[model samples]
Target: MRNHTAINTFILLGLTDDPQLQILTFVFLFIAYLLSITGNMTIILLIFVDSHLKTAMYYFLQNFSFLEISYTSSCIPRYLYSLSTGDRTITYSACLSQLYFIYVFAITQFFLLTVMSYDRYVAICKPLHYVTIMNRRVCRRLVIGCWMVTLLLMLPLFILLLGLEFCNSNAIDHFGCDAHPLMKISCSDTWLLQQMVVICSVLIFILTLVCVVLSYVYIIRTILRFPSAQQRKKAFSTCSSHMIVLSISYGSCIFIYIKPSAKDDVATNKGIILLNTSICPMLNPFIYSLRNKQVKQAFTDLVTKLYSSQGTREILK
Candidate 1:
């Protein structure tokens, strides 16, 4: 009896077959890993130290920065290790765990973005109710809810993948563990679970998309009604950052899931997933941190204090 798709583990092909390319890929990913970790960590450290950043917005942002770092670390570093060593094997349990965490981070991030957008809407569109609506209690609960919902939604992918028996092929084409790409290799009919994936994807997408759109819609309307040029500029500046992130984030997700099938464009689909995982996390800190006056000031003051203290230590020495 031949094993058709009974793969206990998978050999991740990584980026390229060429030896030179493997080295290049490793170098590039290693640098990416470093920058992503360093950049996200700096935000977390600054947010932690600066009392100025203790507000609801930065709190959500802190969670986001942490998630970004985790998301990339889960996929890229493991892929880098496999590519560099040429031993592409991933244990069955490892692959499942990877899949679960990927969804946890990704789905949670989307919901978190949605929550952030709603927070902005309250702050901008309804200033009177801003504090009342987005109180510390509410924000904390909502953030926690995002994490919970993402974990619950991601369970189905594991359930489906686990039940299926792989006959022979155990190679995952991409650099890391991906649910869809890995599913494509199974001998069993995955159509039953495609609906689950679609439903989860749509629920996540629709909720986030709707909230983001409605927030912006009101935000735009409110900005238009304002007579002061300063107010208009402030509104536009604040909203634009959220808009940029929402567009890119949802666009990648919807583009990938809405496709007729995941098998249609394995490389391109993985590329888009990579984009969502790679660029979005790094972009959040830059977009959210730099644009807001409070975060910027906190960042500046923290750096200034650190350097100033260092100088004082040298003088004292």
Candidate 2:
């Protein structure tokens, strides 16, 4: 890995320059970040402690929650610190590290979502074989495979980024260190890097999207053939939370990366990135918990147990 870059630090031109707007943005982001951490952590805790959640579906949900926390943390805290301290300079190594983790977590999320869709497919379409197909060993392997694939895919691009020479400009237009923004400021011939990025992104996007679509196609077909209306509703309900999450995730990423005009719209891209990193992570736990009866039941039971334990301790005192 060659570090040929002359620039050691890059200045992030954050969301806004106005003091009032920065304050407002800071407050909003702080709240969102706090809620996102709390919510995703709660889900992880619930899955860990609740016996009722010891299933393949909940197993994947737990991993997904962890990813959400990691993904948001990878960039949001740095930006918050920058906003609060008026320190926008990030070291080159730190910026590259952030860029790597952000991509890893984000890309892994897409693969995980695709895995989740397959889990649902097996559960709904092949109910009799669901347990055998998505056993503990298989689920664990799937999660690990997602991480491995992401790392392998990102390694080349990251290596290329490491060799980039930034001579003219050090200003990143976005709040966080993103691939495109970094490339935008590089003095190196970025034609290869850009092509590699496009190829990797399109490959990941299309492959996962095709899997998700095929899974759902089979799932919908199976649901429709169910004889009873209640059965169809029940089947659809089980997958509803996953479907919603998939839509939000893929939709935001598509808008930002896949759209023909997205690269030219830097301001709009930043807005979308804020929403994707902060708001979406914050909303996911609520979406699942609200829609999932099993998770709700588990939460109620946990609360009741904790309350009872506290009361007993008071009586003993």
* Candidate that would win on TM-score: 2
lDDT per residue as tens, model 1, 175-264 = 777767667777778897877877877887887788888877887888899999999998788777777878888877778777665455
Candidate 2's residue-wise lDDT over 113-198, tens digit each?
99999999999988999889999999999999999999999999999998899888999998999988889988888999999999
In model 2, which regions exceed 4 Å deviation? 1-5, 262-264
Clashes of 1: 9
Clashing pairs in 2: none
How far off is residue 33 in model 2, in Å? 0.9
Q: On a 0 to 1 TM-score scale, where does candidate 2 land against the true structure?
A: 0.97
The Cα error of candidate 2 at residue 103, in Å, is: 0.2
- What is the Å distance of residue 112 in model 1 from its true position? 0.6
Cα error of candidate 2 at position 224, Å: 0.6
Q: What is residue 141's positional error in candidate 1, in angstroms?
A: 0.2
Question: Which candidate should be chosen as best, given lDDT against the real structure?
Answer: 2
What is candidate 1's CA lDDT for residue 242?
70
